[model samples]
Target: MKVTEKTKISELIKHSPETIEVIASVNSHFNKLRNPILRKLLASRVTLKEAAKIGKCELSVLIEKLKPLGFEFEIDMYEDSSNEKINEVIPNQIFDSLDVRPILNQGQDPFQMIMSKVNILPLGKTLEIISPFQPIPLIRILEQKNHTCICNEKEGIFSLFITKNSNEGLENNVLEKKIINKIDSFDEFQNKISTFEKENKLERLDVRGLEMPLPMVTILEKLEYMPKEFALFVHHFQIPQFLLPELEKRNFFMDYFIVEEKEIHLLIYN
Candidate 1:
């Protein structure tokens, strides 16, 4: 018989009694009249309180709404909550026993170094140099030597705060601002000239960045071309201990040495 909008469900069942008989037989054994997929779809449509009932008014309203949407469904009214109980219990146990392991020593450490030197070549009143990145530890050392380190990462300019030899300690508090104003802009910093002579040469050279080239090696190399008396080589955790022998073969001079910043232990290079 052709299924139509006007077709009565009871009339169709009467005409095909075997279909009802098969469903009734299955229901007798399983106590489930509707498929699980259809039950879930109905659960989403009907209110929770109405979904729990076999033939609730809200369920009838949902079924009416679903009919036009190509779904002809019925509720499977079973009293068992065993499946939900099992689902809730198993998840916690499964997650608690999960194994997630991490690999060890898979790559070289970026901050690996045996020993390094800070060549604080004085430029009369201030220092001029280029570095791979911000040399914070070296700046601290310069500060200890009564020099203020003003670093501008954006313009790639560094200046040391200095005062007249006699008035050095007196102007310590205003040193940072003094050095900052000197390199206020990239144009000012690039044009400014250093007048530190050999006898009172205060330009510090840190060739450590040259020893261990950073990701910005091209920039460092370009800066190396510019004429500057004393440059600083700020060494960090990048220079490897194993490469120190090969580095020494290249005749690199070392002055002030520190094993690490936190620990003030000086490293003796053979």
Candidate 2:
């Protein structure tokens, strides 16, 4: 396959697994690709274009690095277009906003916080996000959800304005209903867990002790290769807010119960 700016990293890796190392060699920022779990989570969302921006390197750098691997590239695909401006207008009335710089400073993931606000934001109303740098992954995810984005940067601080499209009411409502049904009560969660366990179709993972993104990464990796008949029971410190949306995107069924401040049980099935 001929590589282009829009080619997804996951697609490249799937085509040639060696592409992971080649791409990661372009910049130190891409070293995370060496982690199998991180690769699975990020590669699917990032394109060669976005990767170049995130890596703070020229697109030609990535293309050249992968050339030795026998991958073909489009002519002049490395030309810089990062200064192209998006013509989206910011809404006058901001419905909700979040500043994730503090969360990042604390070594925490702000994805859950950001998604929570987005889930309730009304159509035509805007949600503003302030951060230290451009959140390319989050922006990509939101754009996929039918939100238009406009980003501005000043003195190193990034302000992102996202507005949900007025035409997405039906689809967003359906997703909201799905979110409600996916959360099970304690009794319901217990019953499903017991049934799966009795049938020996339950897999267990404990992510309570793991760090911020590790827990999310490990869980997704397990789900990626999970058997069709198996359900995964994860022991987590608190509700994995970020994982919920990802699970929904993957068409996975989930049930969870918060046991206490530091104990949460989540059951994921196909």
Candidate 3:
């Protein structure tokens, strides 16, 4: 049968008792059915929209539950060149008008203080933010809590913030090494972040002052290797909503604890 909009694969299976044979035949050539969940969904004989909803819902729940632990979760939305659709859906201008001073002025808050001095710029049509480590005291506090912390720099001046959870004992030497190691060449740093995520050893990796192509490329790579049992703590400056769809296309996944200055959002992807 010709696959058309009105025809539901799930319905086809339900109507055909030999559906399993057909599915097996197709799966033999393409391994998509190797995934039990996907196989089950296909076997259910549901509409393609229903199957997609199942996948989206599963991912959403996973991301939500991972929020408290600090994960960077997102949905990927797509659009065309008119810029009208993208702007209407995921407005890039929000960062240009974002306020940070108030968040920074919040008394004795570490996340707030760190975000205050950061600057987010537009890279192409995408938004980017850099939050560097400005307050030494706050760094010490996070380190004392046994978490991994990162500070970014542009022209030797601090500019971005990213962190990961850690259990290592904090000595200045250890903390310094962790931060320093995260600064391998921009490419290396990005690769290392993915490796850390894959290995579940990622303790807060922050990228700053890197040029175009680097951020977008790394973001794509990061999504590909997103860990199932890790949380990402990020201080949002200006990031894109389309990142999620980009990741979805590649089957990328991640959960996030995104602190935009002070307001916190938790994201989980199952």
Candidate 4:
């Protein structure tokens, strides 16, 4: 099969099972692909372009590795100008800055803190995130919300600048409300689930025991082929911060019941 930087790792593996080993050899980070579950979860969400970033390797390296396996390259990887653009700076008015290193040091998730700032972000104003490494998943999630992001790395530190586009209609308060609705009350959550169940249009999925990103991946894959009239009932471990913006992008509304600190039930519907 023809391959490009945009080609998904899953597609490459499906084209040639040997790709699993070949990709794993690229970097220690990719060795997780040796696990069937990790491969299924990660490969689907990542492309060769993202793999290169996540693995901290060059795209040409991946292309070269797969070339021996008869995979056709879509572009001249050696001369690709895309890498030059990775460091291009887009000037944005910085309104707020968040350093997540301390949060990570405390063994805490900074997603909530990041999203809180993102939700109230003013148009044409940028939110700067300081991190030890590129937060690719967080970048992807915010980009799905129509936010523009430019990331630059220096000395193993990544500075990501994100701004909401004025043309995306983010200035509309109604649209903002529609984009971030969280039903947290147990009574309200139960009522919504009961209503969906009674209509016989509730589809069930359990992503409780899955690892990070797997739960998000599983939920997104299920939603892709979900019937429009039906709602998805998801048994999850926590409110998936990364998944929330994606659902909002797809115009899906969500409600959740916090059964415990680690057990949560979500009702997602259009």
Candidate 5:
């Protein structure tokens, strides 16, 4: 198959399993793809073109590297999107904006950060998503949930203007309304813990739809500064298999419960 800018990383891997080594060898950071968690969360969503940008490698160089893997990219696809300005684009008018490039820079998935904000966005309010590269997969997901969006590319940064699709009846598909309402600060979150410990307050970290390592990292980091009596609550979309062992190693046990078939809650404590 002819490689194009829109060719997803997972498709490339599926088409030719050898492409993984070629992509990883292209840059040190791309080596994260070797991890199953990263591959599962990112590979299906990131395009080859976006992969090159994320890897901080020249498009031409990445294209050349792919040649050995039986994939050939067109010359036009080699033109990096960063150097070109996206013209005639009118972004959605948004008062609130989120810049998740910081999270990406820290080697964490910014997917949930964007979704979390979007979940609570009210009528007539717009959410601007700022990222290092075009977040195509997320845009597609929002589109599925019936959100209208406009995309813009300036220099290397991509901005997406998002608003709930009125035609779709303003449905919040990714996160439940109860969970969105449940979102609170560290202090407020502590007030709503399980009955297992009354004296030991618990903080809630709602990670619904958060990608792999980000959820695990956020939980562990919070645990570091937490009081010995404190517990941590997690609202997740799925079980974090990778985090279970880490919690066990720290002598913390987790209790899981599902609510309304839409949200899963986990309580972690020593």
Candidate 6:
């Protein structure tokens, strides 16, 4: 069967029960594919196309993933060329910038301020918005207008780059880090994360600013050395919808909290 955006998850699973693991390996949320609640609640209603939009995944990537899982579908190479790449970045790429952290800390909404500034830009200009965290909701709004966004979080700061003339595709895929090293000396829980960050344990594999397959591959590789039972904290622009199932298959448990919608703290453990 040819897989299109409208291909429902239930139909895919019905094609082959074995596909559950196959598709789940591509994302974490799909791990819940076996859950009665999710299956009954969404599997039937959610199509692959809708899932891509919900998970912020690329349609082409989803189609490619299905191929290895006994899903023989026609490949539409040019079908994705028009899409913008939202993950990979060119260091020091020039752009117009706006910082909204201060406005946010003052209990003011920066939306209007940001729009006021962005609206004045020349056509095809790049607008860089720095914030406290990755604004997934905001990006969703911009995408509807044909804008491309590259999201990055560093040292508690989130940087979002929006461009009108986009040349690449979006990379929302992520990984499971293999080297989950902890601080040699345990300090208070609050200080523990800080120490690990300083020790580079947390920085060892920052999947942020990386593209697909690279993200997923990096994560699976890291999971190899990550300690079982000890919590591992990861920062991502958005939830790794595809990677969730792979983590579940590995017997790992995870829950995430968003840091002002700029950065997501994915806490993973056994």
Global lDDT scores for all candidate models? 0.30, 0.75, 0.36, 0.76, 0.66, 0.58
* Better-scoring candidate (TM-score), 2 or 6: 2
Return the top candidate by TM-score.
2
Better of 3 and 4 by TM-score: 4
Rank ordering of all candidates by lDDT, starting from the highest: 4, 2, 5, 6, 3, 1
| Model 3 alpha-carbon miss at residue 52, Å | 38
Runs off by more than 4 Å, candidate 2: 35-37, 75-97, 103-126, 131-141, 150-161, 170-191, 198-200
Superior candidate under lDDT, 2 versus 4 = 4
The sequence of per-residue lDDT tens digits that candidate 6 reaches over residues 1-270 is 666666788898888776667666767746656554345335665667655544556777677777777676654544532224433333334357888877655444566556555566555667789886555445644564567666655555767787765323222222234422223332333465565567555523466666433454566666667765355676665566545545755777655555656455565666
Q: Which pairs of residues have clashing backbones in candidate 5?
A: none
Number of the top-ranking candidate, with lDDT as the measure = 4
Alpha-carbon RMSD, each predicted model: 32.6, 4.6, 19.6, 6.1, 10.3, 14.7
Residue 199 in model 3: lDDT = 70
State residue 226's C-alpha deviation in candidate 3, in Å.
4.7
How do these models rank on TM-score, best leading? Answer: 2, 4, 5, 6, 3, 1
Total residue pair clashes for candidate 6:
28
TM-score of model 4 (CA atoms): 0.57
lDDT of 3 by residue, 1-270 (tens): 333222454554555444434344432322334444344323344333222332333323333433443334333323212234333423432233222234334322233323232212222222222322233334445445443334333343333232324334323232221111123244543553475568765534343333322333344444346565544433233342323333444443444433345332222233
lDDT of 2 at 69: 76
Q: By TM-score, how accurate is candidate 3?
A: 0.22
Residue-wise C-alpha lDDT for candidate 4, range 209-234, written one tens digit per residue = 76555677788888888899899999
Let me know the TM-score candidate 6 reaches against the reference structure: 0.32
Report the Cα lDDT for residue 165, model 4.
69
* Per-residue lDDT of candidate 5, residues 1-270 (tens digit): 688887899998999988889889977969978866557557887777778767777777788888977786755743555434332223444657888877655445566567667767776567888877565556656776777766665567778888765444333334322222322254433445635357647687887655544666667777777887788878876555445544655677666665545366777777
